[model samples]
Target: MSAYAIARLRPFAEPGEDVFTYIERFQSTLDPFGGRFLVHGGQLDEVEGSWPGYAVVIVFPDRATAHAWYQSDAYQELVPLRTRTIEGEVIIVDGVAEDYDPAGMAVRMRAASAGAV
Candidate 1:
């Protein structure tokens, strides 16, 4: 399954050298893992509750690849520079298959809940 490394970052101050450096070097970290940016903190039009900051989404070949990229030495080396200027949340999630059905998942969940009772 395809997986994503998503982040919601809010800046503490005006973007500085560290922020620029992180952006410049980000692609190299993803190169070895076959990761690509689907959304790189671009402009967003909000219609819901709230999204107070920039949203970043990087898609990888699979969950394991996503995890590998996150834990790799190259990315870890840039963590400090990224964290120094921005603050927010990051998560990894697998994308659903093309033919996935929510009803089937719900049925399985209900059965599991019933079994637990």
Candidate 2:
């Protein structure tokens, strides 16, 4: 299945030059893992809720590729810079397949909850 890197970040501290430095070299870390940005932080429409931060989404070929990119040494080295600048959450998530069925899962869940499965 495809995977994604989703992060919601906003400046919590006085951002320094290191944040720019991290951004400058961020792409290099993703190249080896075949990760591409689906969305990079920008001005939000905010039609629903009060969102004062940026939302970033990156797509990878698979969950393993996504995890590998996040865990790579090159990416690891840049972590401190962002940590010092932004405060937010980042997560890797698996994407559903094309033929995914919600009804099937509901049925299965109901069975499991009833101790039938």
Error of 2 at 34 (Å): 0.2
Question: What range of 10 consecutive residues in model 2 has the weakest lDDT sum?
Answer: 10-19
- Candidate 2 lDDT (Cα, 0 to 1): 0.90
Error of 2 at 76 (Å): 0.5
- Model 2, 1-117: lDDT tens digits are 899999989755566798899889999999999898989987789899787788999999999999989999999999998887788899999999999999999999998999963
Q: Which stretches of candidate 1 lie over 4 Å from their true place?
A: none
Residues 8-98 of candidate 1: C-alpha lDDT, one tens digit per residue: 9985678889989988999999999999999987898889988888999999999999999999999999999989889999999999999
* Regions of model 2 farther than 4 Å from truth: 11-14, 47-50
Clashing pairs in 1: none
